[model samples]
Target: MYIKPLALLLAVFLASLRLAAQTAPAGHVVVTHLDSKLLHGNPGGENPRRRVSVYLPAGYEASPSQHYPVLYYLHGFTWNDSLIFNQDGMKTLLDQAIAAGQIRPLIVVVPDEQTRFGGSWYTNSATNGPWADFTARELIAFIDKQFRTLAKPGSRGLAGHSMGGGGTVRLALAYPGTWAAVYALSPAFLGPHPSYLPGPGVGPALRATSAAEAQRVHTTLAAVSLARAFSPNPKATPFGANFPGSLGADSLARRDAVLARWVLASPLYTLPIHPAALRQLRAFAFDWGAQDEVKHIPPTCRQFSNLLAVYGIQHTAEEYEGTHGSRIMGSTGRVYQQVLPFFNKHLDFSP
Candidate 1:
């Protein structure tokens, strides 16, 4: 199993921003919530619907008629859903950056992607619940329908970090026509590890267990969750590692088979032949920290980058020094800048 390392340089940039946050000017923070009943699965009846935090660029509220390109920002694990509007001084930084000419006037939508575990691999799974569909189909559809968005693939951008980084890639693959650009920040690469642990697959299953046991099970089940989320097999159970429902030696064999499938789907592996898909992509890029403890990222990223080169997929991949947590703010800010500008360059935003 290979884990991608976080970048160290991004951490330094985030640290500097943290210090700057102490004395920042006021009245620049912006937060607005959209009632996502469209994503609630029911149009009527008072049920708890998801709320999306919309961060407008400077002069957005003042210029009501002006429409802006939309950037769908997926949150990594361990984030407060409410903080889609708050937390990490994100709104303030976005406001400041837009004001400072660091980025363009765009609509930023931050949606929570956290589940029972620290994060959702952002793949629709019978085991991991409805996150994949919620994000890929429901969330994106809802945002486009309600908002004054530049509703086109070229005008849309997708991005995330860690678990969300994996999600950004997964979703982009699932819906290649949905986004023109994607930015993965410190993406968690699930190398060629065979997913053997299991629980549920995808579909509704009720196997009640104690909360303590659930947590305990996660030790073995985390890989299963990642697999089920990323590469699902509804026929397999507990769940499928390679094939479905085998044990001991047979399961291991099946697991190896499944790992091959994962390698095929990985950006590092498949981008070489799918030049059309890669070409459809306006921008594809990712960055990691040099101090990142996870060692697999550099090789995996390089492999993916090299494959992109074979297909003539123009992209920017880099490694900077930073850890997992320290680089979120700056990396996020940079991604937003890159993502929006890519859309601006590709899309005819002349409405």
Candidate 2:
């Protein structure tokens, strides 16, 4: 009887140890509500205060003196920062990768870039406020100050999907000295001289007083939003001066002017002009789905890649078997196997 009791106690203790190990925190996902002064008092009325999610690897707390490199992730059009952790399983994937020694542990940050018009495309605008500045300058400063980071451009990496991917491309080029490496996943590239016409009912729909009415028409609304980011005219009536003729006038001249503005913002056009900046990056890579639903994405990405090749800029470009937003979840292994390892290889993690 004594032997049986002892055996039972041992079994219970072993189970308890396993349970404790399972229940212990793998890492931390801290959500901080940041009030961006850079985004304050914008015409769009998008909330200046936004949530930024920071992922601290396991042992971050224990290793007080040790600093880690930082990776800034930009999300797609509709997806905000929180989705990276809550829905996409970023923390869990990172934990598993770190445990397996597949990738070196580092800090990851996701900033909210949602606007009244769905997504900001991570651009600076009179209407959308200085979103690029908010991300590149202000947010970086905040992260460096708050966390124990390597805090240098050489130690930093940027990655994004879709709109965020486009942001990574634009931001990396514009701020050449900011990030050492860049990975753009299925970036939404509109080409150098995109000819975008306002969809049916775009004019009357934008005139609607409420946000719901404006958002009901998806395609036109998205165009207007991009126009708001690129060519914002606060003086224009109703919802400010947007592309494809603001509100009333459907003149060809006005439309041409709008397209001209968009051309100026296009990475396809800007990349050729800024070859030196592209060459300055330590590492650059972009990938798109083989069957990307966005018709323009693959061709544009290929064109952009060709442009890079023309300029003798070294970069990685791949086509994967997935659609837009399909591989975002940790189930895909793209983030764990590809993105993290890319950053680990390029980013300087010393000291």
Candidate 3:
């Protein structure tokens, strides 16, 4: 379908006016969704909606005729399109990064990938929801048609944190041709680790004790839901059910199956399937706080790095010293620093 670039720009610009009243910084942008009534439930499902927040560099207006590569960012659970992507502080961070020569000028788009069960994990699922298609097809098409972006995979980068970090890893694996570089920050659980058992705190975190508590405590339950939701074993667990499958022996087995599925989907497990995809990548980087609450930060980082090493997939993995939430604020600037250069190194902006 044809999309008007000016129309998309106007829509976001107006939304930004409204967003300015919120707590976000001065230049906070708005991310909007355009649903496809016609394509709903097809391979990409109908309702091909695009939720995009764009950050243009300081001289974006002066150089009105210029075009730039785009950065696609996915937000964590509980955060809608506007929270991280459209926030004004992030825009200022980009501005500072560009000014300091830490990174080249570029556009960053953050979209909402949260599905019915809290988050899609950016995966397509009956249980977790159709976020994969929403992201890979719908969002990309809309942004390209409506923006002045350099409409090519090599000109693009994808990154996220927490649930979004999983989305980044999952999307990079699923559509190896879509992005030239990727960055993930403090990603959630990958799969069960026999050697990496959870601490006693994990009991409260996993909520393995009770169903209601599970719903309240277990963020890992989203992993299970994404498993059944996106890639289902219908025979193993019934459709449209809460994750961890209602807390019984059968439920536990089903949850384990979900974990097995995660292992299959994880970058650590499936990097071999897309060796060329990995090779095409200009950069792959992920970092987590040494004291991250959700997952064992160091081990997970090592796991991904070791897997990359085995496949000769060059990547950068670091263990920063911070927690999940706070570090993202401090590190987003650094992420832009890493990402913009990666794109500059890979994507040729000249026509």
Candidate 4:
């Protein structure tokens, strides 16, 4: 029998992974599969049982009686809740930071919010389910009950990258009582930027012959994903969301309708509406890469930072030297230097 070359390689690779797991580090990465009631009846019929990645510091088990602060990390579009070994190992990175006293020993939680359309945007909508509610209520309650967490608003922080970064903004504005501090890295679609709307590449996704081509086509699926997240109309076409004539005519009226929905969902548009919520945050910070591949992101980041100033909100925003995904992870990245220090400076770490 002749096996495909890729299949043979995959089998060998998986076996190697199994061998490595046998010698896996003593670092704590709790794998908890949680079934959420909020996502139970999604229009997209996505699985409610989500696997969350939790990182507990070295001393967590030794000091069982002690409670620690929590930081919830949301991953970017098309990316799941993890960074692998070569990506500077999520557990190893934290262990090193704690060992160096760079930051306080704490628990970090990451949820699998990837959906059939690629991402949930960490927002509540009829198409993708109540993602925001699931995080703010169910996930938090479960973590608190199952771990020795400092379970309160003052002790919790929220952060994300790319789409996840935008989620930090959405969650802070909509559910300020859940986390005290928040940060975003290279957030997208800030204040209804039109550059993100779907283009012709989305139309070719259906006919894509190769996986790589399909992946390229899938980038444009953000149109479908964002529509499902923002202006979800269960009775509408295109995955039960009004994707502004995605498969139909791209008319001016249709584009306007879609843009209107985007504004309603944008943090920039909602910033004024939730002045009190933004002010209530113990700390708020976000940054972007000056050389971000996503051309509109750098400017949009500025737009958001400027808007924050206009509203008299106290927050920190900066532009660093890197690309959208370049400076996010590993030891020499924003996660290690900027994000962690920001949280440590703000989040309550008192025993």
TM-score of each: 0.71, 0.87, 0.74, 0.86
Maximum-lDDT candidate: 2
> Candidate 2 has what TM-score?
0.87
Model 4 ranges with Cα > 4 A deviation: 1-26, 84-88, 198-216, 246-253
| Local accuracy of candidate 1 as per-residue lDDT tens digits, 24-126 | 4333333444454333442111122455677666565676687777777777655644665566666776655554445566777777555444455666454
Model 1 lDDT-worst window of ten? 202-211
Worst 10 residues of 2 by lDDT: 193-202
lDDT per residue (tens digit) for residues 91-154 in model 2? 8877766665667889999999988877888888898799999999999999999999999999
- How accurate locally, in lDDT, is each candidate? 0.58, 0.81, 0.63, 0.80
Give Cα distance to truth, residue 115, candidate 4, Å.
0.6
Candidates 1 and 2 compared by TM-score, better number: 2
* Per-residue lDDT value at 80 in model 1: 46
* Candidate 4 lDDT score at position 100: 52
Candidate 3 has what TM-score?
Answer: 0.74
- What tens-digit string does per-residue lDDT give for candidate 4 at 200-249? 43454433444345445555466567777887888864456665434445
